[model samples]
Target: MSAFSDVELLHDFLTEAGDLLEDVDSKLVELEQSPEDAELLATVFRGFHTIKGGAGFLEATHLVELCHKTENLFDKLRSKKLLLDAEMMDSIMAATGEVHRMFGEMRNGHQPGAAPVELLDALDAAIEGRTVAAAAVVEQVAIQTASEQAHSPVVAEDDLDWAGLYEAVVGVAPRELEQAALSTGMATEAISRQAAAAVRPKAPASKAKAAGPATTTAKENSIRVDTVRFDQILNLSGEIGLTKNRLSCLFQSINAGVVNDDLIKSLDTVVGQLDMLVSDLQSAVMKARMQPVGRVFQKYSRLARDVSRQLGKDVELVIEGAETEVDKSILEELNDPLIHLVRNAVDHGIETIEDRIACGKNPKGIVNLSARQTGDHIVIEIQDDGRGMRPEIIREKAVEKGLISSEEAGQLSVQESLQLIFLPGFSTKDQISDISGRGVGMDVVKTNIQRLNGRIEIQSEPGHGSKITILLPLTLAILPVLMLKLEEQIYSLPLSSVREIIPIEEDRVQFVSGKPTMVVRGEVIPLLDLATLIGRESNPGPKVGVLAVSGDRACILAVDSLVGQDEVMIKPLEGIKPKGVAGATLSGEGLLVLVLELRELIEGKL
Candidate 1:
């Protein structure tokens, strides 16, 4: 294989190896709680064994040796000769870190540094003083049985054809396997044989049953096909849709002229059917990119455990809606924000054990992560049972930082004050710590989430807990919008942001402090004219189209006319933030229009 192929193969191996390592950490944490779980121990042993084998083939002697030693310690525990204690668990956890560092160094195209020899010696020492008399007796019985069978016909176990079994177990493409083999310095054929052997059942009865299926059972297998194929299909489907749209335009022109009504009606029906088929195809292709949130949520178990241990706090992390699926792209971008949030919950949001207990709460605080689909949005929430935010303290900090006047802070609601923490360079901690309270994380969280066109909401009670809810579009590719007219130009508003629309008489509007205000349901709500805000003023008319948009606060938008609702594909404004525009969309009338940013518009009001 070429060098490029080798690099690609190694990169893929590194990705999978990282995932496996994370799994091992999580399993180890679970074993801490259920120390006597035999199956869990077996699973951990197999994972380490697999890592060792892979590293050995790659000539990563240091990594292989580390895993080998770790595996030996597990072997002693599995055989009931050694007991699992806190010290042993800590040592194993440190070994996990060592292996991870070695893998990281190897991924960066350098040799891994030697691990601490003392740690290796300590691991070896843990296996001493174990009575293996029962293990030896069992080995003797197996050896005797094998010796008894040696006198009979010697059928070679290695003679079994294993190509089908290899495909069933690994499910990697033949070429990918070949590349992996070349990179790892193993013969492709040998690696394939080993994969088959690894998956084979040890029981004699299962081996006998493997030979009975002669009817060519279609394999019932799958491969991890590249996502680029689905993307291509989606692009082609989009082109077909555009063609259908143009054809509809032609049909409208024909209907306006002298045409056969029957033919026109038949053509319309066919076009509608084709449109539905194309939509279904798009939906199916998009679903292929959907992955359950559990893939990302699983890593939190290890993170929570390690961070809580380091901080000397006892915290339990719980996950819900692990089965909710989102686009792969969204899932990938969401990892950092989620990590930051979890770390913040542990480091800042949750109080210490004594503090929590004194507050009449569980000493081991609970951090719950959940996601669910609501309309066209996916709502992900992180709630922590800790000392929630105190609005008064936040107000004092804001006043000290000059973020708000003391009088303004005194009148602010709890929800509004909690949002002040998200401001840039705002920290509530008295002293900066390594973990958090440096006033850096939450701002980045808000910025990154906004770049994805998502909104975050904070809810808290002083003594209960706090919940941060994030609302994101299901897919960024397409969105449902409400199209409205401002003067002669049409603009779109994401339906997710729009609350409602109402027609109001111009006479009922009042000016409050040189700004337009309207009374709706006994509440004074601020109103902004869409044209004037976008720098295009129009003459006052008899009635105004009021678009009520709600974010952290509610605002009324006055436009010229309500065009209608639409399901338009949002095209981002690249390299520039348009004046008072959130995004641009193509209307059914073949016109380009801008979408207003409701949050920005409301913020501009202050």
Candidate 2:
């Protein structure tokens, strides 16, 4: 039904174009920082040119028209026919965003609509020697060369009446300040504070209307793997088949009554070979699912640039250890949580430019996004060199929001207080902005990380900065868990959450605030009975206790006995999923054992 005739060609174009556009975005951001980098400029130009050629081949007129305009703009930029400025860069960024939108439509087998009239006019404006600023708010903060901004001077707040200035530049009455703020994409709070302190005039909106995040989902069905890895998989599969044939022959020989040591030995050798082969095959497949974290990391540079500019803050997102590999499935789910954290670092964690200068810190705040692998887990950190969080302040905010009682707030340690931010509807901000403050950002970050069988830790020092560390298993396909016995049935806790299996000492168990508690090395840990947590009869005199931690909360889980540890593949329950149970796995004896959701159980009990 679509006008595009070649479906396969279109699919290939979308795949390649998506990657090209992402690279272009990163480079464009860099280009703004270093406008004289001819190589970067050429690379960006070629990116658009290649995309335009593909669209032309596919007869996607809308896509081609958009790309051609962008390519020409870059062409002029490279030729020195037009001096690049923040305004032109805004138009370029907007054009790329529109291209991404068009890709979305083509993916659905529909031809994209034409570029907006305003965008074409802006492109035409750039082509000529006039400044044709688009209407509304700027989508990006233009990165200008030193020479371009050198003539601009910082104006003191007392030097000008902001109300008169706003009316003069924006052609609106002072009473319409809020409406004007909306049109310029500045928060009203920012306008009230007269925060547009930059000497340059406010940049106009991009030619295209504000484009939200390119509509993408975490459920990608296709993945790319290296040919070498595929070959390794094939080689292992072939070896496994040969071993299976040998195993079959050995079984036949035994059934034929050849009772020699040679026959028995041969059978054992074949069985060992089959076991090793299967293990190798599994490792090979999991390796195939591994992808570099850079694929996700590369997307955030533009994000940081955009949000920082939107907030009128100077922030730089620095990425490290991007070559670290993670499960492809995990990489997809990580996108949103990472976006939230990065935005938080820019909006909440980083101080305003004035505050940073006043605090004797760098005017341009640095946000570090890094990833690395330790053992079988990936550790990611989002660190900001801005205003660090204060435990006391966090606790106070939590109390004010009614998330915790005054007494509860008083009893929390610094670490626990930091964890309070993860509570739903907890925020420290007095004024709400589009970026943050309804208290949902940190909550989502914690929830998503925990859902991946991971844990998040926060470290902060007021005035220094804040660091949020996340630890996640390498793969969700298999889980290593501690098996426990509860009234003759077995349940498993994720090994990552289990600190140790301690024998419950009756003397060590004490009642604190009318709740059962135990002192382990001077730290008091509350004891939650496993049976009681699941609404079953309480287990009296439970001999074994498992020390488990979820988020920053640690507790002792009383169980009937310890069944040791196992690596298992969990299967979902068919119809009914009971609370506190993550999934079902099989025990060594072929019995169905439930895998407990450690965080859910611990939080529910608390």
Candidate 3:
């Protein structure tokens, strides 16, 4: 196969494997509830079987063997030879995790190491009713089988045609070849004889069968088209849009001058139809770049389980809206941030059994990881019923780290104090653990989220759990922003950050210690002049555009004017970072504008 074909095959495998892995995690959770579920057991077994088979074809031996052992264990359970219990479920889930890790390694061009020899040994012991080291693989595979009086015929090991079975099991030949062999009633030796007899003549038939399924499947679902092709399509759509605009302009000019009634009406109708077609095509192409959030959520199950076990805590992760779709590029960048957040929740956010007992809380803490669509944004929340943030302690830590002055810390609201945890080199952990609290993780999480032009907010109560919400655009490639003007230059602010645009009367604003303060709805809100913040030495405009910022603390941004709202394509500001710019966007009229980073702007004022 050509290089293109190889890449296409890999892409298909990745996409399918990703989905299966997601389903496996979800099913594992379901099995926890209904440990004796026959259908869930079968579904998980088949999923592992398919993965093992595919891994074999891809020459991923470690993955194949690991999954093979897992499949065997499930097979035993399904046949009513074992019992479903917590220990057994944990071991099986751990093995599933190993498979997931191996797949990741293979994707990154590395050879995966074998599953812990002890793990496999424990599995064997579980099958044979023996014990190993400290951990014993539980026997959890009992299922209801068909009644013995109506026993189904069982083919003896030796009675079966071993050679044909081997070929089919190993997938040495294409699926069609195996199907054709079954259909023709030809033994392995008979197929070999037929191949030798015709030599050249039979070659085409064999090749046809070998390549037929691959080709047809590739045409239907396997082909990995180049991203550049999508770019080219986008360009064409843009050109078509521009053409329609230009034609409309011409029609308007013609109508004003000559008023050719029939031609003008015909042109208008044609332009309308063309516009709709172009719009539909653009939407379709954009949809191709979207993938379900389940791809990101699935890996967390294994992480949550492992971390909980390691910490000797009983924690359950509940996920919702796994089918929520976001752009593929955004999904790719979301992995690390999501992992960090989930790990933090399990490690630091959720309390252990003893601690929970002391606090009079549930022994098993629950961590809810959910996603939902809000307007054009996808809000992903990680909420836990663990010991929540102590704002006073966070403030003290921030002061110790020299992140904030004592005076500044005193003025910080509980929410503002919680946000300080995300500051660089700041950690609330009393001691560093392998899981978290080294202070290096959350800063990276914040930066990565910001790089995607998303915002992160933290909400917590002293005794209640903490909730971290990450609001991201549906697609980072294009964003809806509110464009504004400062110093006669255009700028954009993400609509997610702009809670509302309100005009503040000059008299309503007062200066407190040379800082602007406005009382909106009986609450004193600090206002920062955008022009002054960006180092633009200009007089303040009559009207102040107040942008409501989202974070631990809320602030109002006073800008000169609200230019307008626009659907702008966000372009990253490379090299020299603009002092107060979060991103750059092109206006509908094709002009570049700097997007203000409200968080940074507010921070600077402090």
Best by TM-score: 2
Tens digits of lDDT, candidate 2, 271-336: 898889888988999999999999888888888887888788999999999999999978877876
Model 1 ranges off by over 4 Å: 1-5, 56-62, 94-262, 356-362, 414-420, 447-464, 485-489, 502-550, 557-562, 573-585, 594-596, 600-605
TM values, all candidates: 0.69, 0.81, 0.66
lDDT of 1: 0.69
Error of 3 at 35 (Å): 3.5
TM-score of 3: 0.66
Candidate 2 clash pair list: none
Which stretches of candidate 3 lie above 4 Å from their native place? Answer: 1-5, 84-91, 110-113, 134-262, 265-291, 325-333, 358-360, 400-402, 405-407, 448-454, 461-464, 482-491, 495-563, 572-606
lDDT of 3 by residue, 201-247 (tens): 32345553554443332112333345875776777677777768867
Per-model C-alpha lDDT, please? 0.69, 0.77, 0.68
TM-score, cand. 2 vs. native: 0.81
Pairs clashing within candidate 3: 77-141, 82-142, 83-140, 83-141, 84-140
What does the lDDT read for residue 132 in candidate 1?
Answer: 32
